[model samples]
Target: MEPMRGGWAEEAALAHLLAQGYRLLGRNRRTPFGEVDLLLEKDGVYVVVEVKQRRTGRFGTPLEAITPRKVARLLACARHLLGRDDLPVRLEAVLVHGTPEAFRLEHLPLEV
Candidate 1:
């Protein structure tokens, strides 16, 4: 997706997460491994969110975009940001489908 569209999707995802009571810690955070889309904290646990947006389902669902490699990179980046691997970290995905004005989003916990 285009950067502008990606930004819009991220903004939408952030809003959704915020409304769900997840406090924002960071956005587009970069580490040695890669960039983490959103870092959130809720109930004392760190949430590493991967925001995936799809305008259409021609290719696949937004959640289908997440690959094993992507998960690994996200994990590495999250651990790097926290400076430890033992902390409670949860991987999640904010799957958005449709335009910014009319989108459906689902928050799902991702398995490590």
Candidate 2:
């Protein structure tokens, strides 16, 4: 997919997370295994988030784009970056759709 106009849906998702008290620790964090769109923490629990955007819903909901391969990659990325901070972790996805002027946002927390 093409890059979003201002960063990606990740930016909007990140902003939303921050507003909801999630601390921002990383953005676009990448490793040889995979890339994490947003890394956050809430009450010491780590969160790995995927932000997906679509201009149309012809294919499916934005969340439907996450394949098992993508989930595996996200899990690997989180594990690779876990280091010594063995905090509880949660995987999540953020969906953004519609025109920039009139968009919708939804959050989906996933089980890793």
Candidate 3:
């Protein structure tokens, strides 16, 4: 993806999450295993969200960027976040792209 397009997607996601009453806990949170794009909190539950951005349809849908290997990496990152105790939480994917004023948001709830 183009760097500029990717930036827009990230900004759009931040705005979307904020509008949805999700508190931003952290951004680009990295662990020994991998990195989480956004760590959010809502109603006392944690949400580990992976963000994928695509400007065009050349490769496929933006969500398709997430593969089995990516899922494993995300899971490992989640485990790192839960090092001490079990956290009431879920994994999610946010696909964002398009014009700044007309961005699209896709939320995919991941089943653990």
By descending TM-score, how would the candidates be arranged? Answer: 1, 2, 3
Report the C-alpha lDDT of model 3 over 1-112, residue by residue, as the tens digit.
5475466777778788889999998888899989888888988888888889876677798878888788888878877876744777778888975556666789888755
* For model 1, the run of ten residues with the poorest summed lDDT: 1-10
Overall lDDT per candidate, in order of appearance: 0.93, 0.84, 0.80
Model 1 lDDT tens row, 1-112: 5466588889988998999999999999999899999999999999999999989999999878899889999999999999998999999999989996898888899888
Would you estimate the TM-scores of all the predictions? 0.93, 0.87, 0.84
Error of 1 at 91 (Å): 0.3
Q: Which of candidates 1 and 3 is the stronger one according to TM-score? A: 1
Q: What lDDT score goes with residue 104 in model 3?
A: 76
Q: Pick the TM-score winner.
A: 1
Best by lDDT: 1
lDDT for 90 (candidate 3): 74
- What local lDDT score does residue 49 receive in model 3, on the 0 to 100 scale? 88
What ordering of candidates by lDDT runs from best to worst?
A: 1, 2, 3
Better of 2 and 3 by TM-score: 2
